[model samples]
Target: METNFAELVDAEFALEPGITYLNTASLGIGPQRAAAALHHGADAWTSGRSTFAEAEAAVDSVRRAYARLTNVPPDRVAVGSTVSAHVGLIAAALPEGAEVLIADDDFASLVTPFATRHDVKLRSVPLERLADAVRPGTDLVAVSAVQSVDGRTADLTALRHAAEAAGARVLLDATQAAGWLPLQADGFDYVVCGAYKWLLCPRGVSLLTVREGSEDGISPHFAGWYNADDIWADLYGPIPEGSLASSARRFDSAPSYLPYLGAARSLALVEELGIDAIRAHDVALAERFHAGLASLGLDAPSRGSAIVAVPGLGRLAAPLADAGIFVATRGGRLRAAFHLYNGTADVDRLLDAVAGRL
Candidate 1:
């Protein structure tokens, strides 16, 4: 059965009329449920209805939602403010003198944390060469599940096998692949994502998952009140030997209240719509967009993923924006990402604009 994605989610987004939004890779258009949740959070704060328990519950709700989406246990999910923040925590938790492997095109957040560490050694390899790059002494291998610039999806299963053979761990940045892609949470030892993009939520909330037994030797680099078993009790007395929360909750850092409320609602909406349906819908739109661009004598790197990267269109982003079509430019390619709210009309408009410009 053909999916009527427009009927399912178009009404829930606030995209402006005549403006085609294709920059979901850069940031997603906030859904109505997230906006309503944010409003409710504001009301609770202003009406004196907010409490510590309420805030903790909101955080737990968001964590559980992510856990469900990734098919991991709730205790394995750790909520953070951003992907970079969680990646930083992971970097800090690594053993001294650890060696890390990353791709040359990885987002700076993944590279910068380890790059700056004097005790850690960093190696950069091309995306296609990542599997071969894994070897003994490589403590961690990190890469995005989907490359942001070229729209290439990584084979996590293969990477996991290579990492395991080398006695290394895998960290996957699912910022570009999480909501619309079917992610197997067990494939990677660590998974991190920012909620603002494919998750269709506001910024300031991210989901981080640590595989079972993966947190064994890693200590929380940035511990806070929430990381403790009981904040008041810990504060009032000498900290007990095992006062920290037993699960990944020990790594939790406090985030702004508003984003969690909205994040919970955004996750609920995705679950309601069904992620498999969402992935199929996005792939169909992306294939149509690829075919349309091909007819216009333009070429894209890949066709099945949510992102379509047009060669040489990076320089035309401003012109496209002026035409009321939005996209992002990275690695000298124009990246147009399709989401549930996008339709055939948006693809037609993009193709027509590029054709007229050419």
Candidate 2:
């Protein structure tokens, strides 16, 4: 696996000397291709050479690319600037006084949307017990495919079954799972993700895939000219009847085009490398870290995940950062996430740093 990605690391990433980046769960370091794309977009922007049509086409191309990657129709995928915005659409569509089942301690963006809805009764459960907790009255089951805190993964299959038995819909936040994990939105009623973390896109790019026939249910309260069939035509006037797209585009927020201009190249890199390969590479590095932690008599549950969270080590995050080993702290745990660009040396450096701090 190291041999497979040795050259890719050199070609894709441009980390500073003596730095070890193991925080892809927080923000992915984009490849040179994506960087180049961003620069090109910036040049076009400053030169006033880019047209609205070109920008719209580029954004839609990424939307279609995401749809194709997830095995869904392009019409079902909506582009947005944030997961909260996408989740807000789903929250708005729920019936009054509906019951929403969610995992406790989930990411704020995933939780706040449904929680903000005063009409819904939210049932909180542990991610591990989410499936068993679903009951007869659940109107919806919302969870993250990968928990942001401890790297625990949700059992989507079981959750789907439980939700189906309760006549409920399923929503999944794939922000932490999409790039290295093979993800398809067809299994759930709705899927929302921020692309900056795992998908290696710039900030301000998000994806929302609404299941077919869900278009009528969701009211796009945030809809703007960007969602119109002819965005240019609807730029000024009050949008007339039939102006908005009939599909999920009705939910597309006004885009930050420069980010989407660079997104396609990043997504294309994922397709070229294949997610399975990236997953293997990432999980291997994480497993190595877990073993190192165990050898040092630390609590390291072997979860077979790309992210490893070490209990009682949150205090070391600052020290590790100062030493050029970057990680995150969540739930009072030191979180280290491995990506395709990381290698065994990176893992060993982190373990060594932790050992020194101890």
Candidate 3:
């Protein structure tokens, strides 16, 4: 049976004629309409046509669009630059003198912010030991839903139960898993992701979700005027009392208006095409790539997400590069990540390029 990948691609985006874009988890190729939206917003800013009203609408639209994608209430999502930017918000929300629990191979962005804090103790545990590693005084249990390098998917529901049992809040760095898996809103206290990876928006823009009631005692470290509910305030006056929107909006600083507009356009396009349909298409394409690589006698590791890793053929870099193939390597494995934009042709080309080197 021919998988539904081609139909899904045809419905959403047409490829750039001859480019085989299979590294989407590294940086997604944004949709053409989204690129146009970004350019239009940039042109407005450059020409002095940018207005407060337009910026406000664009920011709100992007936040709501990300909220819908993550299955959360619209008010609970915030806008940010990258996944790391929002992790600072999570680190601040954590109780003082608290310890954070994380898997050993989690993305560094998720752990680096907490590591810099002297008051918060960092606890790094193995992925296999995470369920048993939660301690009594852990204030926040931090983890990546999918490891960016290895593509190992953590069981969020299980981790949530363990953390809640230990009286700890759950912070999920889901950049690698967003758009590839179905995320349940209630399963996390906080979650953050960059749209560049799989959502195919611009690189700097990201999404953050902080569950209602879970963020009661938290405050934004980097406060701004737009963080206020009555955002249209005269800057000439004394800083108004900080009623920071009482939701996830409290966490965001005033972001540049253009990327948010582009992100909203891209997110809306994805939703109209259907997220589930996108996941199904990508999953099948990944499977095809894996099978073809195996037939070429390359041994790739079995991971439950969109990324596949195989041992690099003993420094087989120049040969593959000469053949016009691109992939990343970590822990002795060459990594190939795919999104809905890729198809069988990209996979076959990769296999042909790497066959002899391995």
Tens digits of per-residue lDDT for model 3, 1-358: 1345455456557665555656676778777778888888889889999887886787788888778878998988888787787888777766778888888977888999899888888999887678678879888888888777667778776787788798888888778887777777557888888878787788778888888887764567776776776666634454455555777777786776777778888888777666677777677777887788767765565445788777655255445555566566666667778777776788878777677555
* Candidate 1 weakest ten by summed lDDT: 1-10
RMSD in order of candidates? 1.7, 1.6, 2.6
lDDT of 1 by residue, 125-147 (tens): 98888988999999999899898
TM agreement with the true structure for every prediction: 0.95, 0.96, 0.91
Clashing pairs in 3: none
Q: Report every candidate's CA lDDT.
A: 0.85, 0.87, 0.75
Off by over 4 Å in 2: 1-5
The prediction achieving the highest lDDT against the true structure is 2
Error of 3 at 41 (Å): 1.6
**TM-score ranking, best first:** 2, 1, 3
Candidates sorted on lDDT, descending: 2, 1, 3
lDDT of 2 at 91: 90
User: Candidate 1 clashing pairs?
Assistant: none
Lowest-sum lDDT 10-residue window in model 2: 1-10
- The ten-residue window of minimal lDDT in model 3 covers 1-10
